[model samples]
Target: MILQGNDPTTGASFTLGNRLQRQLWQCVWLCLFRPSPRPLHAWRAALLRLFGARLGPHVHIYPGVKIWAPWQLSVGGHSGVADGVTLYNMAPIEIGAYCVVSQGAHLCTGSHDYNSANFQLVAHPIVLASHVWICAEAFVSPGVSLAEGAVVAPRSVVTRSLRTPWTVYAGIPARPISTRTRHGTAPD
Candidate 1:
């Protein structure tokens, strides 16, 4: 399981150490990461790496991107997370190589179970396969996995996995809208 404490009534959702680390990270974000210039993608990536994020070479994470729990994040080579993107990765969020997450996009990996009496906290991993493109302001929900070359239209919401590779999806529920031509093979 990606999450630990389900019931907040029993105790805090995260452990004390986790909470402390988050606090420290928040401070660093405010003081260093957030204030850095726009062109300093490597600097921001280094900061995220310090927090335990597994990022490959040439990954571009803009200064305005908000990342919750960098430890649970892994972004592959040549992936670009644009400005105003939010990665709410309560669980692990693995982004494959050559992916583009456009500005204002949101990837969420945690939610509350409304059916549960205690309002249990549940989380799942989000995986974006290589060559995936999430357009501006798109929302990818928990447990979603976008196949290789999948494209999510702007402002669309994805609840389930997009199983078909090289397809484009749009609308509230993000149904398949069109097909895209696949490019080269997997990167070395």
Candidate 2:
């Protein structure tokens, strides 16, 4: 897919670069002022929007939710990014409608190339499908996908893809813990 907010070929553009700088400024504001919960949350979301975050309707992002670059983050309708969640999105991060990113969760979207002489950087996108629940303290590494209706339990570290719908995933380098309906009932 064409990664939103980035030129797939050149991977760089003046507009995108300027937006990235603006996002960093917003992060600085968040770190310095430490505004109250409600207003802070709203302001931060607004800042993200200003920098090209294509958030659909009713996206709630709490204060203490850190985003590396707004240009790299997109949230679909009715999504919730909870407090203390950090999105290290040096690359694109796409969240589908109704996704819930719980408190303290981390979505890391970039890494350094250890073999490179200058330790060059590399980035990959993280995609979360509709109705996914990333539980509190969970981490999603770069290039991972959490498919629709997938529930990642608290403290889980997801390194691989979770493609099946309505599956529960837990533990470090998260694995499927169980499978159930969206309402939590096991399928017959």
**Candidate number achieving the greatest lDDT relative to the actual structure:** 1
TM-score of each: 0.93, 0.80
Candidate 2, run of 10 with poorest lDDT: 1-10
Q: TM-score for candidate 1, please give it.
A: 0.93
Off by over 4 Å in 2: 1-24, 31-36, 39-43, 183-188
List, residue by residue over 83-170, the lDDT tens digit for candidate 2: 8899988789999888899999999987756665544567799999888899999999989998888999999999988998989999
Regions more than 4 Å wrong, model 1: 1-11, 184-188
lDDT of 1: 0.92
lDDT of 1 by residue, 1-188 (tens): 32353567777887778788889999999999999999998999999999999999999999899998999999999999999999999899999999999999999999998887767788999999999999999999999999999999999999999999999999999999999987565663
Q: Estimate every model's Cα lDDT from 0 to 1.
A: 0.92, 0.80
- The collision pairs in model 1 are none
